[model samples]
Target chain A: MNAFPPVPEMVAAVRSKRVAPDHFVTESLRRLEQHGGTLGAVLSLTKERAQADLAPLSARLAGGEDLPLAGVPIAIKDNICVRGTTTTCGSRILESYRPPYDATAVERLVRAGAVIVAKTNLDEFAMGSSTENSAFFPAKNPWDLARVPGGSSGGSASVVAAALVPAALGSETGGSVRQPAAFTGIAGLKPTYGRVSRYGLVAFGSSLDQIGTFARTAADAALIHAVIAGRDPRDATSSDHPVEPNQARSMDLKGLRVGIPKEGHDSAIDARIRARLSATQERLLAAGAVIRELSLPHAKYAIPTYYIVATAEASSNLARHDGMHCGVAAPPEKDLLHQYLRNRAQGFGAEVTRRILLGTFCLSSGYYDAYYERAMRVRSLLARDYRAAFEQVDVLLGPTTPTPAFKHGEKTSDPLQMYLADVLTAGANLAGVPALSIRAGHLTEGGSELPIGLQLTGPAWSENLLFRVGAAIESYWPEADRLPPFVRSQA
Target chain B: MIDENLVRSVAHLARIAIPEARVPGLAKELAHIVEYVDQLAALDVQGVAPLTHTNAGANVYREDEVAPSLPVEAVMALAPARSGNFYRVPKVIGDA
Candidate 1:
């Protein structure tokens, strides 16, 4: 029940039998009811409402409505709001909060006949690299239950990799989507900044956050991305550029130059992850992608710079959540001071509180220049390096993360270690490029199954090119549907 | 390195209360970040122009226009406390 049927297989199922949406939803619900809480991925399942919504779509399909996403069920991160459903951002403060309107991404899926199944958990406000910071529950890696699924999009990645959902929508403020995708062994793409509209997404580090998608394959990702991404008058940051067909890019990597950053190759990465990445390079070379070595001298500074800028922006965006006015309302005391203070003290979680403080410190008078300004300067150098690399090569290659997935709480004691874990993903965000993480290989024969991802970073709006190369690599070595033992046990 | 008091002060400014027990932990954690950032002082970036971290060459622009914002009432409605047209809140500054 948990094995991921390829996107074509699911579509064929819909087209061949005109699978009833109710029947499809019922089966998924049964799988979800038995398996969801254990994974800690699903926050709230819209069983009653989703079933009713699926009924009409089922009827339409039975009547021969050829909806592209007809009968397809998808999950969205809690940060991306779906109207009438709770969008908590995995914080206690937002637990009862519901968006008055749907996010552009949600609207796209709903309009395309996709069933809104559930809102998945995420790190509180997408601040942490791992989902352990979620106030509700930390999502466990589906592969090894003790391990993390990566984050702040951990729940989104876990559900897809575990085959609970075919695809999911996630957001990346640094490596939130890609890292989780890499850790959980799923296909994930972070579109160019402003390529996707920010309207209706709960804002956190607005300048850095881009809505990305996660799927079992690259083609499925492009299809979902094409549906949601485009210009919208609702969001000023949204580009007026016509939505280009990001799909249709085929397995053509011939004559493409893929750059391997000299610094990206670290001896510290797990040996198995390195083996998979090296093998992926061989496959790309076989397809005629010339691999070149380039140096980003300022790559070391990416982590600090990302945090400074991201957290500073996050501080400003989250300011509206003052308990006095927005989010969860506390008791009205006689004095405004007690009312606001008590509300805030009780509302925010430990992780959210810690970030707000760090962000506040960075943005405060007398220190902004030393921290925020300097960090901005550092970010520029990283971008400059990428620009130079792009002049010579079409894409850059590296391991998506230093390691695949770590046991939960291993890095919780030291936040710096956790921040450092994003070393590979942060540089791409700072460079403002379209980057993706795709599973390249597995380890340990039959008994022990470990997955590792190879990352590709391209110039802005070059996701189509990345897919071309991705499809080539995937073609050379067709990735089997690798599911965890837990799912198999259920079947 | 960041001291315990700085952590407490920052926490207060952010309106988040850290129990006394957690302050020591946060202070230790924050000190590592501050210590690592100090490495920048060793670099010789005297004359280099600050790079634009927003590396993408394309400036995704939309024609500027005035549009309807969230209805003032609806926005104010999200506020836990409101007074007339304004949101009610604790005085950020000292009371006169």
Candidate 2:
């Protein structure tokens, strides 16, 4: 267990009679039940359903079925619909929201034989960068209990990092996936815009929300992604692009070109992370990659543009949860307007409310041109910069986030400081490129170790290239296998 | 570029009653944010024709068809108070 077992290894073991899927899934349910309330990593557990699945699924495994993820226990982010489970999105309003259907990602994982063990926590409606904004229990980082797990997909990172499951699903709305991955020191990927279906993911910013995965290794991520990536008739925004398998096996970086943007070396990035990014590039160079320098002139505007556009979409998408519906209804409001207003104010947490307000203002009649339209224009220029650089290089390398996990409440009071957590990650979402966060190193401050991540990005649907470079880099740093003490103690 | 009056007005539209007490603090935070975003206007795109997306796809939306709505009883069951098939609510906007 000390070695980070790839999903394929676990599958092979289950298939070869080394371990039983029932035994593994049973223990996983027990461990999740024991750790759920304590770690706050899980919001709901599919106990009876999981138990019922084991017998038939175990029979399938024993019969030598070609399951994409045989006996691999995976968690779904609460925002991602898991048919019978509560997709809370970490808000009190949807405390009992049980969608009659599964999200496209869930269906893909299930059909591929991945068990939906539990649903992990998330920021309310995927609004904040830190998990603290969750109206339910906040997911504590496995690396440091007192510190926050970078969110809104923080719980997904924590579980995979904690080894509660071999893999999990996470969504990124402006680095929600990658930042938490960097903060928790796991490998997480945000597929290119529309690469995966958005059919049942509770919408945040439809343009930027991407359903991705968190796994211990890049190869495992590629395998899981292959299962989930395809056109969905349900999601109009989903790409019908032909599915391309990971070419990582064929990826020999002997002459592959790599680019490093000079803007990535800004003041906000931590020194340790910067050094790790440099070291990763050096390793790639040693592997025969021609590393070049690329500068994104408008990199600084990414945060503003992301916040403006994401929040604007969030405000509209969230309007459907009027209390009179299945969500928390206000106690007998006077009329329809009162019903919507009262329920919304009470249902949403402080952070969710703040974003809705900000988004509403940006999309308001008087300010749309100045804010929303302007942000869209800026988004184009950012995409152009990446395109111009991509013409010269195959992939880009950088730190996933400035610093690793910040302490809980470190930036809660200062809104802008909180926004800066995604400084290194926001640009990818704006550019609509695929990016991944892979655990690279560790930092020690006051004897409390924090995990660091190296971000590798590629042009649309170029995630295969990321797996190639990241798996190469993952070989150099073996700490990815080292379990957080909390996970071991709880086990 | 942002003002307190606009903040109140936006708050009104959003339906959240932000106290005047918090308006000053909220305005200050929003100002810093606006200054950061205002830089977008500085780009030298005299006629770059704002691009919608680097990759565009038309909506494959299916025709809206009538299907089984949530059982009216199950749906209204969630409402706080009700009279007949309609939901009952407080007296909103005078006698109307």
Candidate 3:
């Protein structure tokens, strides 16, 4: 059975006192205990912490205080700090480090009466496309235990898909949230850059990173988005642009101008997935939405540009984990420099080390102009592409990933093959646009049916419009209500 | 091509000690990624501006007021090694 009802239903029930807040927490904890280990979705459950805070929250709710996310049980990707909780970014280095403060989003979630029950896993420092790069363990897809739940937000995506949690917070540097959500057949939203605050979110590609939401449906994703997104003085990059709750009032697709980016439909995409995307477009057309073939000519460069810029920032941002102040340290050595090196070397996993090296090389003095600066110039061009395309249509549509989730160890050995997983989704991060990924279709591969997602990206801060379009697609998509095999077998 | 030596040097610069055996493999992987990213060189970026950040906001400043930070003990408690009120590190300017 699902642990809880949808966000709005649960919130209304809890707020109206018909359902006790503690009841959902109990169910969520039970589900986490049941499925978390099997799916490798949970790193640590904050059972004791969550229970201790519930009585007071229960009091607040009983007192008739209005909380938008009242009584909701949510999971946070381990990278985002929850005060006094272990904020491991899926690396052994800071495996046991507890943060002293809550991330701005976490602060908002708690203030709105949401209980953070667990910390989900991710690729180390959100570097790799697959959670297989997690220093501890890879999160498996609920659809097929043999396949990876697309990552670096794999853990968050997995738990939501398996009904371990109603909603989860995942950070996306490049396709982390959307890709994982796509692979897991859930709704994921990467809010426009600056639409959400990054304060206390462990920095990885500071310019590209945004705290995104994952849920079973786009409307639930929007509920979490509304609660968490807004300008935070702590995050200077956060915009003061007005943010209003974007809950879908109607699944109205009338006259919605959706642009089909020609680049997004490249031959590189899996033909099966493309067929699903076309079917979704047909659904939109049937609903009176206008569709146009548009061009984001520079879309192809998004992956390479995102890699350079993201890694460059990661290299600089990760410099703090020298083991001098916190995290795992090397054995005492006479040379401080060597000790620092050894501490980091031992703490970070292979993928983290690779990204750090790549980033360092990109930002190195001689190569800066050729690699990093040039990538930045190309990034500007990519952003311009979105700007121009948005002028032509309200949103750009495409397959979220080239294909469905793959078996573990399939792309692990080949780094390039793994990076390609984000090719279709990373453009939004590069352009700082908001993108929503919702399950549009499913394909039977290797005897198991895996979900495929369609991504709808809009111009910056246009999350409300994206949610509307996503809801329309979700309504038409037959597979949205289907349970993953893992959940089905258990039932 | 990224050579093993370059990989080692880059690791050192990044303050990570990579094993000598892993250097060759890392070098190969970095070379592959670098080569893939080299596609940017073909783009005509002559007139384009570098966008380091998407936020168009200028420097945001606040009043210089004393604010409470995490307690010193709380901050110190997180350190891997600490002596008194300072983080403890290996000898920097002393003989081994």
Candidate 4:
């Protein structure tokens, strides 16, 4: 069965009046209502808000305003603030909290004529590798219902892969977008750290957080990226660099140096996934790109270093939800200090609590130099490795994850095992570079065929280069165009 | 290894209330993570400057001119407990 039409084609159809904007909105809401519950993908449906915004959108289109995404329906992860709508961040702490302003990325999408149809579910405060850490419910994989859709962006990935909306927005501190995108066959792009503004994305790891896009094709991902990227004065870290137009129809790879990092192909990668990576490399070679082998010695240390740095930042960022400032408070105590302690204990979930405790321990007086400071020093080493590699090659290629999607409860029981999920993807975040995960091929496990993703990394502010190469991979290795069983059954 | 007593003190420092029953389990979990991350100790990180921000962008300056800000009512709308223009928290001082 054919999947949803590419975002560009959908926009063309809408502009020509072949399909009305309301038609897209109505259809998306219908599918979301039908499948969202069973798949555990949606946190809240913004049907009322979406309908309220339709009139002004129609007026703009009639006024000949150039809206590139005119009438397209889209989903925002729950952690992103949407004005007058509940932005839970998949935690009970802020279950009723509503931001008075829109996130910078969400604001841009609305200005471009995209309708916000729903707030998708997520791991609480965007911390886990699986949606099981979600305070509400675990989002399931569309390919095999019993398995997990890799997360903290699992719901966003599931909806896009199931062709519910065409595309959605997800955030990545460490592999949240790419891992889920790999699990559910699609394209996930984590732009260079400051490439997209983080003005309104709920902070997880302040220094590492980035908002990314999810779509069935790399070209469509580029369309969304162009709208949301670039500087916003509110976000100090957002780059002032001009947004380069990266929607090339085809790219020439002759003499383009692609590096295959020896560290990325170690025994830690599943044998089948390693085979898929090798095949992806052959295609690049056939296209005239010279493949070079290299080393990143510090790559093995990324996971531990990321956990320390990320948890430390998270501990500091989450301190504001003290119940007195905002979010739900625990039952009143005799004194303010007890109230503060009770509020946090009752509000945050297990993983969140564990992280906060770990973060506090790392930054505490006695252990500061041993844990937090040392991690930062190692973080510098990771960044140095990326700098050295970029000097030799234009792009680096590797597996997006060690293996395909595992069973939901498989890794949840072991926190260390869960942390290992981001082993291959965290180095990019630590070094602050752009990485794109695209469907390379599929591997069969049991009676089901699971998708494998090939990742491409480049130096900071190289989004255009990354997207151009990503589009090339999707052209020849076109597994992204196929629909998952859930969508096929509906047909 | 992180002992249960250390876990309790850390939780206290972090301002999180932990039930006596949950402390042992939490202690074990924290210990595993701490030990796993201890692998960094083996590397000689002497004299290497800690990298805080990945992108080396420095202080961002803007105009000092005042601009429109969110209304007080809008900002206080999400507060769990609020008095007239103030967040109402539990009493801070104890009666003699």
lDDT of each: 0.78, 0.81, 0.89, 0.89
Kindly list the per-residue Cα lDDT of model 1 for residues A348-446, writing each as its tens digit.
Answer: 777677677778888888787777778777777778788899999999888888886888889988888899888888888877788988777566533
Docking quality band of candidate 4, CAPRI definitions: high
lDDT of 4 at A321: 78
| Model 4 fnat value | 0.89
Docking class of 3: high
**What would the per-residue lDDT of candidate 2 be over residues A1-491, giving only the tens digit for each residue?**
23236788877777777877765566667777876667788888887657665668877765767787877888889999877678889998888777767898988887777888989999899877888888988888988888888988988888788777878899988999999988888889999998999888999988888999899888889899999998987777788888887553425689889889886676668888888878878888898989998888878888988889888888888878765556543567556676666677678887787777788888999889877877888888889888888999998888888887888889889777888888888888888899988888688865678888988889998988888788888887887667787876653
Model 2, residue A93: C-alpha shift (Å): 1.9
- Candidates' DockQ values? 0.41, 0.41, 0.83, 0.83
Q: Of the pair 2 and 4, which is ahead by TM-score?
A: 4
DockQ score of candidate 2? 0.41
- lDDT tens string, model 3, A187-253? 9999999999999899999999999999988888988899899999899999988998566544677
Q: What lDDT tens digits, residue by residue, belong to model 4 across residues A395-464?
A: 9999999989999899988899999999999999999999999887688898887888889999988877
Task: Give Cα distance to truth, residue A30, candidate 4, Å.
Answer: 0.8
Error of 4 at A70 (Å): 0.8
Task: Give me the runs in candidate 1 sitting further than 4 Å from their true place.
Answer: A2-4, A15-17, A48-66, A326-328, A445-448, A476-480, B44-96
When candidate 4 is compared with the true two-chain complex, its DockQ is 0.83
